[model samples]
Target chain A: MHATALAHSNIALVKYWGKRDRALNLPVAGSLSLTLGGLATTTTVHFRPELESDLVSLDGRELRPGSVAHRRIADFLDLVRNDAGITSFAEVETANNFPTAAGLASSASGFAALALAATHAAGQQLTDAQLSVLARRGSGSAARSIFGGFAEMSAGTRADGRDAHARALAGPEHWDLRCVVAVTTQGEKDVSSTEGMTRTQETSPLFEPWARTVDADIAQARHAVETRDFALLGRVAERSCLGMHASAMAADPGVIYWNPTTIEVIHRVRRARRDGLQIFFTIDAGPHVKVFCPARELSALRSVLSQIDGVNDLIVARPGQGAHLLES
Target chain B: MHATALAHSNIALVKYWGKRDRALNLPVAGSLSLTLGGLATTTTVHFRPELESDLVSLDGRELRPGSVAHRRIADFLDLVRNDAGITSFAEVETANNFPTAAGLASSASGFAALALAATHAAGQQLTDAQLSVLARRGSGSAARSIFGGFAEMSAGTRADGRDAHARALAGPEHWDLRCVVAVTTQGEKDVSSTEGMTRTQETSPLFEPWARTVDADIAQARHAVETRDFALLGRVAERSCLGMHASAMAADPGVIYWNPTTIEVIHRVRRARRDGLQIFFTIDAGPHVKVFCPARELSALRSVLSQIDGVNDLIVARPGQGAHLLES
Candidate 1:
């Protein structure tokens, strides 16, 4: 069987930072995110009995079998094969519309699409929650990308990881929130989230308290989303982002993901808010910033953000759909 | 009676960040610092019976009586008067060799000198510990400046804050550690550490854990200093600095102190370390970075840091003496 799926990238409002279980990819805290429109990954998977081994290519570049990227894909495929009880070698090709590994949540879309495509290609039917679990096994944020609009990833108590998955909080039409991604650098980050998270969890003394208070953040953020309280949501989201980055920075040797441009964008966002604009900023593990605001304020947000010296480009996105099968 | 005192600034190897009591300026965590040579603040205080009001001047500029700086001076004088049982208005003159409110710890030396000079000029005799306690009421880190070489400030459990004073860990001859201060920006920081600490303590979730773990950090750092372990001291010191800044960054509006040049200095420090230099970088709540290393490697360290794009100047300092009376 051959299957294709498309998944849009997500920007976490309440970030899923440290991992509870590194092997199972279990998060220490719950997270919330909005699947973004305009930037996505389309992944295709084909299981062929004639193939001797799995092959993986990203953006038309065929990766060597033992390389990190190829190994990650192969490992993810192994999980799908185990679930479906299939031994056939597979060929996977994935491409993203935005920059990869530059803190743009590309992995969320990539793994979400791969999970759906690989599972379907292997003739297995799974619920969205099950699919989310499978996606999370590859990348934690990918679990949230399985749902549209507002989604929450539960940091389940189960040791088996059966309950750890994403659920849709609201659909795309729930609110008219928009995200303006101020792309500072398209280059990949020096430290990947996987490495950075592990380093922080192991080395940072602040990680315990950070992990301890994440539930409160998630609860407050969820309430704000339900009530459509823009200010409250912005406050919680920005706080979560800064806390996560702080944990990384407090790590041994320190993982500083922010550049000078990142600070500039943050100051600009704060300045705009002070000037009566209802925009707030949150950054992932890279220098780029995502400004959250309503569609009405898009023009003003763009004007202020574009005026920044180091901002390379801006990609505006609204709430988008979850991973779905693509007709081929 | 009139007295003059001089005190040098101190940089916290283990930072005294959040306050346990805002009104008394009591720290939530104990801190360790190295009193710096070559940067001193000289303060002179004279008690006069005829004067109706306290007069204060900084660097030959007469401050208005009701101004914030003047008020702080007057309030400090009131404390001295209460202690010495003298009810005389005072004239105060203070000057710093470095930038004020720029995260250079000028307040540390300023208050240390003020505490010593004001008390002596009022015909009051106090031990170094009492002087440290008095200085802390003015600025939290100022307590550390009352001791020379390596000093530790106790985060006292008492409500009266008598135990929250600095003590000398090692005199100036104990270690040969030198600090190369890379001045990225000479301008004053936008947010004062006093305001920034309060903001973080009030808003940052990470502050609680940061405060909780500071004891362990202090113990480890103290051991490193006792053992004369440069690498261990560097690691712990760097961790403490990052954690303090993390708490600040996790504040509601966020307090980001690093600029592009600051980041460049950090990277250079790391690169230099990898190249076999025994140096580590720590930043206070400002753009400047203090690179700690041995005196033997000062020239090499200077060459590397000076080549960085944003470093405006470098000041090299060794362990220096605590506050002492200067003959008028």
Candidate 2:
């Protein structure tokens, strides 16, 4: 049975940037993400006895035999075989509904889709927690990608890392929150998380302060989401982002990702906030900005942004679902 | 008089990336900076009614009649006039040892020196606290420049921000910690702290997490300094930088400033750490990386770093002192 598996990348209200354990892929703290409807990856897996190696393709591009992505898949298979007694060469094909490498947590979605598809292909049933652990081995945020809607990956106080897994905080329909992504560029990241987090951990003096500070936001954000306090959610998310960047500056060579246009849209939003316009914003990875506002404010926010200099394109999105089997 | 007045730019560890109180020039968070040893503007202030207008020169260059620095000086004069019950602009000539507009906090140090000089020129007997408040109005981190050694500006809870001010954490002798600065590029910042912090505040979702996380590090860092635990201090500082960058990723147009070479040095540090090397790194607003190894390990760390791919220049700095008037 080769059922297509589809998974959505959750946009973190409280984002994850660094790691506590790079090997285990454990995070420094808990984070909350909204599963977005517009951004997702779908994959299909099938095992063939005739094939000697596992095959992976993304968006119709056949991966090179020893590419990082393919290696990741093969290595993951090795782990699963050693740990879960799965011994099969699987051919896997994956596709993204949204733009790849656009700072949209494609790896989170990609790995989650692969994990679900491959596990199902093996004819073995696994719990969501088990699936999450498997996904985390690939990317720390991928653990959270196994679930949909409002989810939290608890930074449990254990080296075993079993404590760090995703749990649904609220369903997709809990609140009518809208996210408008201002997509700037889609290029390969200069520093991959595997390496970036390691450098930050070793070099950044500001890292410890940032690690301990976000817990309150995590609690507050969850509470805000539960109560449908959209304003609180937006405000807290923005605060969390600032705190994270403060640590970045404290790193040995302080880093900033904002271009001139990024600055303009931010001010436009701030001006809106000052003028009592209802919307809040957050950013992740690339130069793109994601604004969390009510659906009603979309037109006004867009109008304001359109008038501003340097803002490129805005993709409107709402809460999305988790990894699922799609009938071909 | 102006003989005792010293000006220093307030540099943010938490950095005032943005300005919430634009008119007051209040930063989002308190920053820490070292008052340079060589360059300081010393002026003996005496209110003279005979002068038609205030005379101002920066490093032998006379300021035009209506420049911003001139306007700022004028504004400072007016403020001191109202606060200290004094009037009349005194002639001010300031010289900076460092290059102007080189992203070296020259304006901060310059204005701080100018404030000190002006206040002394005005014959105002202001306390360090009062002077800090005055300095903060000029530039957020300048308030901390009033004191030497490790400084911390209280991120006060007061809404009026009257309680927010800089305090000395320790004297230079607290730790033998050495900071080796590698200057990557000498240029003007594309975005100032006022613009950067504001963008972070308004746009980055990761900012809040960063804000929440640093408190623990602040406490630990202070304690580490008190205890003189170099390893702990380095660890705390490194983490702080990571948290800051995490928020940058959450910004609308996210960024990681490390070029391939920068990344290589960081990776080298991590590799060394994994191999049981004891060197720490931290970064600020620039592309350069600062290593915080002890003076004992300085030679070894530097030699190892020299072999790395993208390092340009390395300047070693010890604990610097507060701004002082240099003898002509």
Candidate 3:
């Protein structure tokens, strides 16, 4: 059996930082995000009874069996195999529209798409929430990619994590906001999100406070999303973004994701805000910065950002659709 | 009466951040620091009944009456006058040997020297502990600059901060550590230390946690200083620096003091340490970074830092003497 699916990358307004559970990939706090239309991942999975092991390919190149990428995908696939009650191995091919492992949340979209495709190929019927739960096993952020537009992943209290999954706050048509991404570098980040989060939780003195304070941020963001309050949303979003980075930075052998270009964009955006432009910036676990503003201010944001040095590429995105099977 | 005093800037190993009493300029926690020999401030105070008001000059430029610099000095002079029970206005001239307001702790030296000279010029003889309390009224960090070598400023319990004063941890000759400063920019930081600390205390969620955690860092740094343990000292010093900056960075609108070159130096220094060089770096709320190592590693530290693109200048400093009267 073979099937294909697609999912979009998400930008967290209220970020999910430290995880409560490592093995289950459960978040320590609720997170709010918007799916981006421009950046995406497409995946196809085929289960063959004759295959001795799972074969994984990314961007048209076959992943070697012993490589990290190959092993992670293989391990994720085992969950689908166990659920389907089959010994058969699968050949999985995942393609990202944007750069991989550059802090673009490729794993979010990759695993979400993979969940949909792998489940379909296994001939198993699962609801959206069920798919979200399954996707979370692959990556903590993956659960949010199961829903379009505004989504919130609950930091579930259950030991099994069956109750913790993403829910849609509003669809794409509910808001007309824009995300202008300034990609600063193409190189892979020195530390992965999993590695960074683990360190922050283990060593950062501020991690407990960070975890405690995030719920208020998530609540504020939720209210802003419900009322379409851009200013309120922007304030909470920037605060949340900086708070996460701050906690990570306090860890011993601290995780510093922002490069010089990342900081340049932040300063310029704040300066522009002082000049009366209604915009805010957020950075995930990489050097790139995403500037959030209303649709009408796109040109102004573009003009200001383009003037900055060493910005590799700019991608303008709007709220996009959720993960679904694509007929081939 | 007239007197001249010289004071050297002290860099905190365990930083002093957040204030419990803004009016008294009392720190939320005690801090540990190392006094530097190369950077200093010299001040001469002449009390003249002929002058209508305090005349303040920094370096060669005369400060306007209502100007921030002028008012701060004048207001501080008021404290000395009140203590000495005299109304005579003073002609105050302070000269910084290094860059002013570029995050080099000029205020620490300036205020400490002013406490000594202004008190001496007013014919008030006091102990060093009493001088520290007076210096703290000018600037919180100035309290620590009153003592030489490694000093610890206690976060005193008294509301008036009369009991809160710096005491010498060890004399200058106790440690032979070298601090190689990389001056990244000569420009003044956008947010002053006082303003940034206030913002962090008022708005940052992590501020409370940061304040709570600093005492342990101080204790560790103090222990390291006592035993001359470089590795332990380095660990806590870097953590304290980043933790303080992190708390500031999490504030609403965030008080980010780092420039592009600041981050570059940090990354390069961390990378070089992987090559087996025993060194650590710390930053005050400005663009410059100080690389700390043994005296023998000064050349190696210089060579590495000089190769950085935007490092403007490098100053090698050892432990320095405390504030003392300069014969004129």
Off by over 4 Å in 3: A186-188, B186-188
True contacts kept of each: 0.75, 0.12, 0.71
| Candidate 1 lDDT, A1-328, residue by residue in tens | 8999999999899988888898899999889999998789999999999998998889999989899888888999999999899999998899998877556888899999999999999999899999999999989999989899999999999997989999999898999999999988543257877889899999887787788878888899999999999999999998899988998998887888877678768877877898899999899888889999998999999999999877988889999999999997
lDDT of 2 by residue, B1-328 (tens): 3443555433334333445467776655554433333434454445677777777777788888689788877677777778767666667777665555434566666656656666665666667676767776766766777766677776565666666777788866666656665555432234554455666667665576566655666777777778878777767666666565555544644443443344446556666765766787666555567677776877878777777644766666666566555442
Model-by-model lDDT, in order? 0.89, 0.68, 0.90
Sorted on TM-score, highest at the top, how do the candidates line up?
A: 3, 1, 2
Each candidate's chain A: what TM-score? 0.97, 0.94, 0.97
Each prediction's number of clashing residue pairs: 0, 81, 0
Docking class of 2: incorrect
DockQ of model 2, rounded to 2 decimals: 0.11
Candidate 2 chain B weakest lDDT stretch, 10 residues: B8-17
- The alpha-carbon RMSD values of the candidates against the true structure, listed in the order shown, are 2.1, 9.6, 1.7
Best by TM-score: 3
Best by lDDT: 3
| CA-based DockQ, model 3 | 0.68
Better of 1 and 2 by DockQ: 1
Q: Which ranges of candidate 1 are over 4 A from the true structure? A: A186-188, B186-189
